[model samples]
Target chain A: MSDTPENVAATNAEARNERHRERMVRKKTVMDERIANAQSERGLLLVNTGIGKGKSSSAFGMVARALGHGLKVGVVQFIKGRVSTGEQLFFKRFPEEVRYHVMGEGFTWETQDRQRDIETAGKAWEVAVELLNDPGIALVVLDELNIAFKHGYLDVDQILEDLRNRPLTQHVVVTGRGAPQALIEAADTVSDMSLVKHAFQSGIRAQKGIEF
Target chain B: MSDTPENVAATNAEARNERHRERMVRKKTVMDERIANAQSERGLLLVNTGIGKGKSSSAFGMVARALGHGLKVGVVQFIKGRVSTGEQLFFKRFPEEVRYHVMGEGFTWETQDRQRDIETAGKAWEVAVELLNDPGIALVVLDELNIAFKHGYLDVDQILEDLRNRPLTQHVVVTGRGAPQALIEAADTVSDMSLVKHAFQSGIRAQKGIEF
Candidate 1:
């Protein structure tokens, strides 16, 4: 009786499968119990105040998540318009569910036009307001809009008033450093991402895939 | 003229808003661009290998993202049986989009019935596989499924084969420790969450609303 390695391996695999089957036979299980679900009602969310990593990343991740379910998601990015980044690049993959709009001036320094910056911010705000009213649109991520309010390009009062008045089913996410008192107070969930430490502070240039 | 503190505070608030508006007008602002959307073609995936943290949390985060877009998602947790969890608790918020299947056996040591464990895992897998194929089901997260394979309660190859053949548009995520090499190899993108450092090792019990 010759015993081959292949035969032995096969025998072992069968035994493993048998063991697995045995375990399943004795365990009791429950099917269909979910704890966390997406917010159905309209609410305001402020991803605010602090120099921390993953604020934009987290927001974009949410955007991607929303788009995955065939939801109309509108994103308006502020204080970021240099070269293309990961989020922007990936946004092209799903143009139907996601609409991407940028202020287009790049950072506040590169434009060097104060009047133009305010005009651009105001225009973006108009679009965001319009999106807020569209019930078909499930999420409106105002990326870095806090910086706009902090800089005073757009009226904080108007922004807050509009957000409050927007359709109740529309969920809004405002992200940026130094979110104002008004925005924070009006928001249902306020997440302050305090930066304990960062790689950029240590002189590590942002990597392509990880940072961008 | 009676000068009151309330009057002074109101005046200060208006001045603060004015100052912010002026500063924003001067800043040259740009918006972050969304390059493209998420890779929806990438089917659902779960990474369960070794006890670091961020496994189930990350998975559930994606689930929330999906649900926010009005997409249906299902979750099945093994080894987390007979007990309530933060994820389970949160699922109540969205009773429609999120469906859960929990094994009542809890952990293997607690049950000590290998046959029953395997049977329960098989039953859960049956439901999970059903969801994986459902085109309307955008994302399916099998939380802590690695334990099922590790303890000989589930068949890794069979699961991988099923996933490989599932609906192309549907996304799935699995989270747990000790994920099998076969599953890793089969994944379109495999993120191995190595434990370089963890808060739990430093004498911090899992806190509610954070770790749980």
Candidate 2:
């Protein structure tokens, strides 16, 4: 007797399920091995760079993550001193946990004063150095520090040296566009955020709390 | 002598400064006009997707920004219910500000059961719909929802319809890898994070408080 349509459908479904299970079983084996091999844990040097929107936003998110773990965090805004961003205002609520500093006069084009910018960057580096040296600070965010290096306002070698010399267990997140090759080479984890689309391009204004 | 070395150096610096100032002045005029044109305000659909890190981290960062603005935020984490990430633990502190939900039975590969996965995704979508319907929730983070759609566990059309029907002033952030083309077109701001390097590839385990 010929099998019914319902029985044939059920048989097909079973075959598909079996195939899926076998594929997953193989994938699981590979993943388990990878997870098992990753045994070392220490502080990491993370870089967020490229012409993207979330470079600073992601760094601030890490700040939230660090704070959530009951860890002390430090933030040094290298080229965003002109405006008080949403992250700045929100992080202020956690004064006991976050050490926040805004150190730039403005963007390079806005400032148009190389000597003054160099001075400001110098001062910001000093604050960063202090944070890097502090063992108590588990995570340090150098927001837009890459801009300073890109503009020749700061020395990349010196910055890399400071990053290298930071507390062994203290993680640092450096963010901005045009991260120098040397910095990327030194970083443990680097994410290049590429802008696929932006609201501003579509005539949507930068909204409060969303884009500060 | 025609001029001393000091005098020539000073003259060159002055000329460079003048040129920079002129360039900036022209750029500022264009920027000012653009800023003036962007006077309208509304909620945005922000998408963070790619084969890289920090997609969800950036979403959580926005969560901090939203909370800083005293806005109510909802986070519906799909496909990441097995491990308790740091964001989950940290955001838990803000019970009054954030409504958090972890609604997956782990990843699809780990689950290895299409029928059960579809049911779990359905339940998660129900929760998301409720949040989207609420006007009080300023920001809704549908973390890893793209994966559900990619794996055919959920319908992309239905998801888009719900997103479109959300409160006019409520912003939504969708994050995951391999975001659908439809979602990208619908999004106001989309960031494609490209992984340059990862610590895990170097045998460094995902650390607590950082990777989680």
TM-score per candidate, chains pooled: 0.47, 0.96
Q: Can you write out model 2's per-residue Cα lDDT over A1-212, one digit (the tens) per residue?
A: 35799889998888988887788788888988998999988899999998877888888888877887789999999988456777888899888999999988887778877778889999999999999999999999999999999878899998898888988989999999999999999999999999999999878888765787
The stretch of ten residues in a row with the least summed lDDT in candidate 1 chain A is A30-39
Who wins the DockQ comparison?
Answer: 2
Once fitted onto the true fold, the runs of candidate 2 whose alpha carbons sit more than 4 angstroms away are: none
How good is the docking of model 2, as DockQ?
A: 0.68
I-RMSD for candidate 2: 1.6
* Local error of candidate 2 at residue A163 (angstroms): 0.9
Per-residue CA lDDT of model 1 for B1-212, tens digit only, reads 35599888877866765665555455423211122222122343435344433456556656655664556788887767444665666565466767777754577754656667779898889888887778878778888888888886787888888888888756666777777888776654334444424334333333333344
Residue-level lDDT for B58 in candidate 1: 52
Clashing pairs in 2: none
TM-score quality measure for candidate 1: 0.47
